[model samples]
Target: MKQLPPEYYALLEELQAVDFVLVELTLYLDTHPHDYDAIQQYNQFAQQRGLLKKQIESKFGPLQQYGNSYSGYPWNWDDAPWPWQV
Candidate 1:
């Protein structure tokens, strides 16, 4: 695998942390559907995740092999280095 810059790993770590919180909140909400506080927290985390994803894509590239991240030029998604390889 290719070595990625520290910033890339940092952003990925931050996003992973947000995703972990979201998963936990989801599991809690599954049993206590009316937990308003948890619901709000989940929404906040979800928003954070989206913003983080955008940041990562803008700075590095698409996180997935296919999706909205694709755009003009010589197909960036196809050229962007994979996380594991970077």
Candidate 2:
């Protein structure tokens, strides 16, 4: 199995944190859109998450894809050596 670089692992963790923040903020905003502070914070994390996603995909692979073969890069998410393997 192949091992991911330290940066990739760190980025993965950061992405997870960003995702959690996004989900929580999304749920909160669903009924409280007037919370400008929350909205701004959500947007900030969302943007960071987007950029991290691209960075991950560029180095590792796409976690999720959009449309039919019309995005992302060439990654080996199908085979062995999952994230925890390293």
Which pairs clash in model 2? Answer: none
Residue-level lDDT of model 1, residues 1-86, one tens digit each, is: 34568999899889889989999999999999999999999999999999998999887778875565645465665554566564
For this target, which candidate reaches the highest TM-score against the unseen true structure? 1
Local lDDT at 86 for model 2: 44
CA lDDT, candidate 1, residue 25: 92
Q: Which ten residues in a row have the lowest lDDT in candidate 1?
A: 65-74
List the candidate 2 regions with Cα displacement exceeding 4 Å: 66-86
Structural RMSD, model 2: 3.1
Question: Cα deviation of 55 in candidate 1 (Å)?
Answer: 0.3
> Per-model C-alpha lDDT, please?
0.81, 0.76
In model 2, where is the ten-residue run with the lowest total lDDT?
65-74
Compared with the true structure, model 1 gives a TM-score of: 0.81
Candidate 2 structure quality by residue, lDDT tens digits, 1-86 = 56567998898899899999999999999999899999999989989988887787677765664532223344445644444564
Off by over 4 Å in 1: 84-86
Q: How large an RMSD does model 1 have?
A: 2.2
